[model samples]
Target: MLALEELAAKYIQKTERVLTLLKSVNVSVSPDEKKVYAVVDEAKRYLEDAKYYYEKKKFETSLVSVAYCEGLLDSLRMLGYVEFTW
Candidate 1:
C-alpha cells in the first residue's frame, strides 16, 4: 500500500512538472483572423501531444509538452485570446 501511494505521488509530481511555460518568450502574430485561426489549430495539436507525453511519465517529453503550450499561447495572443504581455 505504501509503495502504491509513493508511486502515485511521484506520478502526480512528474506530471505537474510539465505544467510550466518558459517565461518571457515572445513571438509576433499577424492581425489577420485566418492566419490566427490556423495557428490555433496547430498550437492545440502540439499542446495535446505534449500533455500526452507528460502523462506517460516522460520528463524529457514533458519539456516538449510545455513548448507546445508556449507555441499555442503565442498563437492565442495573435488570435486575440490573450494579449502579448511580453
Candidate 2:
C-alpha cells in the first residue's frame, strides 16, 4: 500500500485531471429529473469537500472524499444521467 505521503503526492498530481474530467462531463436533466440532479449536486459537494481536505493536508480523508465523489459520478454514468468520453 502507498504511504500517506505517496498517496498525497499522487492526489496532488491527479486532482486537476480528475476535476477536468468531472467538468468535461455533460449532465443534462429535465425538470422531472430532480432526484437525479440532487444526486449530482451531492457529488459536487463531496468533490468540494475533497478539495478542502486536500488543502488541509488530511490526505486519507481527501482520498475517501474523492472516492465518494467518483463513486457518485460512476453511478450517474451507469444510470445514464451523465455523458463523458472517459
RMSD of each: 8.6, 3.5
Error of 1 at 72 (Å): 4.3
> In model 2, which regions exceed 4 Å deviation?
1-32
The list of candidate 1 runs beyond 4 A from truth reads 1-31, 75-81, 84-86
lDDT per residue, candidate 2, 1-86, as tens digits? 99875675565446445546654334454344777668778877887787788788888988888777778777777767665443
Candidate 1 overall lDDT versus native: 0.52
TM-score of each: 0.47, 0.67
Error of 2 at 84 (Å): 1.6
Candidate 1 root-mean-square deviation in Å: 8.6
For candidate 1, lDDT tens digit of each residue in 42-80? 655666665566567665665665565566665565545
Local distance difference test values of all predictions, in order: 0.52, 0.68
